[model samples]
Target: MSARLRPLIAALALAAVASLTLGAAPAATAAPAPKPAGDDFPHPDLRLTYDATVRYRSEQAAIADGYQRTDECVEDPQLGGMGYHYVKPAHIGSTDPTRPAAILYEEDHKTGKRELVAVEWVVPNTGQSWPVLFGQPFDGPFDFEPVGPHYSLHAWIFKKNPSGVFSPYNPRVHCGPCPEGHAHP
Candidate 1:
């Protein structure tokens, strides 16, 4: 074959191989589909808040993350318990869903075990608009003691709240029986 013809043939062969290689390449793998929000978590906000706060399911984890347990365990004789509050001073008056001002824990009277059940956002009322989260408004502009007039919202993500996920009190949660001298606050 003529040298020029040989060179032209080699170029055509290289081009064909390149084309075949490119055509045979596997398609890139697609990312897995995200889970759909279920009845347990009807909104993306709730899911995101859960994802951010679930790590604090243990009291120690919450403490390590800058939460300090309040001396009192809050409960209502008729409304049920709100559990022990572990507050993070820096997060006070925060509206950020991921940065809750308090972590709530329910104590097992029998086993003496503490389990984190909820997260709360609190902002003092200065006649400002009430803080809202997950499409629901904050629960107060009323006096809550020490803090005086404030608005608060709770998210019971770690544990199911029968009173409603955002309710201030959970019938299932308890500070357990108050100690001999320690009364339920």
Candidate 2:
């Protein structure tokens, strides 16, 4: 090749390569983003929900915000405990993750103190399909007396659950044996 022609040819090749790169469409099979760290939430909605509800760690704060303790302290010796469910009737059937219908509290047997452990979303089963949150389905269409048929999901955001974060029950939760003849206060 002639010396003068070599430079022009190299310039043409470079221009062709640049055009191919700049004009081509992006790859369709590009890899999805990496998963979040183990301690971090995979969903932004879940993280928002956690931030909104973590303030309920104070039982008084929860009560002041219209959360009322239900009649029973739910516990099952074999299956595990759901602790005391403090529910806000007005918030039921809410689809918003940041607005949970109930907050769960675990009681310390000896001290008679309560600690917030989880948040729950409840939707009345009006024959509709179960609501899904964070890609998980609500647990039931269970009929329980006054509540009738309902679907519920629990997220153990404040407490670690060996059963799983979304599991309905936690073995670590306890209803407790209240002092003397007094029931769990």
Candidate 3:
């Protein structure tokens, strides 16, 4: 080919390569919105209910029950168990006696027996509602530990919030070493 034609050919080749590279580049993905800060935490209408059974009795029954319920519901099925399930309330309501409430269904994994565990109701504030539920493992007249290696299961119910999305708390949020044997605070 002549020098004049060769220059045009090279220019076209360069343009083609440039167009291909640009087209192959991935489009930028939008970043997720940041979470609200402090009391500004996004409070959306929510209700959660579940059943709970205690395997080991603790002084803080509510805390223990909540932990167990959350764990079981969120358990991974591939890891030899059913994972956590998020349930939406059948109706939108409040924490007041007149409003619908959330419920959790808990069971003793070992005995296969089930019972109601916790109840949460949403109370409105400035047009938005926040979740306030009775802590886990209803404390009754009796407090006892598990006899063997048994686990508790529960079904938690909640009201779907348009703005509220559940994301696992960041483990790096804590500074010092976790409490004794505990993995993350």
Candidate 4:
């Protein structure tokens, strides 16, 4: 979901800071955010459990699992690129930032359905350290503010968000329907 910005440069800075770690993230092969074992929840904020496939799975599976496509897509390819919010049904209540009820995906323009890119937790409330929140040392910068009224945290687990691992908006991410000059990200 995109929102009004404080001009492009400043907005990009905020998104970047939110996703950045104190140091460069380790190589992708490191596998920092491993799925929980048995029934354990990954973070304190998360309210539900998920399978390993949820980490970097296909879009078809995510839709089958209940996520829905939305116009609230973000793009921040500047750093690397966080994708867009492919939100879940309205029935999915606001849950913890530890485990996202919804998912994030990158648009596959050629195919149209997009690809699973990342996941997040949009809580009605805010702030938990990066390490404690997602069982990793800052996947992305933590974002207290997002497009909607809620406090959201983005975790670019599957793909690296250029804004930062946790930056809510991806600078390079875009939506075809978003009217021009309206300012999103």
Candidate 3 — which residues are off by over 4 angstroms?
1-72, 75-90, 98-100, 122-185
RMSD of each: 12.4, 15.2, 20.0, 21.8
Off by over 4 Å in 4: 1-56, 75-83, 89-98, 125-132, 135-148, 176-185
Report the C-alpha lDDT of model 3 over 1-185, residue by residue, as the tens digit: 89789989999999999999988875567574222222122322222111122221221353333333333442222222222222233322333322322333334444543333323332223333233333322112222232122112122222222222232212212223336667622
Model 4: per-residue lDDT, tens digit, 1-185? 24555477687897788668634677667866543322233454332324433533667666676666666555444433445666654423334353365677777664686766567654332344333345543333333343333445565555444555556666545555346656434
Ranking by lDDT: 2, 1, 4, 3
TM-score: the better of candidates 2 and 3:
2
Candidate 1: 10-residue stretch with minimal lDDT: 30-39
The candidate that wins on lDDT is 2
lDDT of 2 by residue, 1-185 (tens): 99999999999999999989977855668785333223465456777777788768788899999999775789888767888999899989987989999999887766777878888999999988779988989999888866789999888877777788888988777676645785532
Return model 1's CA RMSD, one decimal: 12.4
The stretch of ten residues in a row with the least summed lDDT in candidate 3 is 47-56
Q: Best-fitting candidate, measured by TM-score?
A: 2
Ranking by TM-score: 2, 1, 4, 3
Residue ranges of candidate 1 with Cα displaced over 4 Å? 1-39, 177-185
Global local distance difference test of model 2: 0.81
* Overall lDDT per candidate, in order of appearance: 0.79, 0.81, 0.32, 0.52
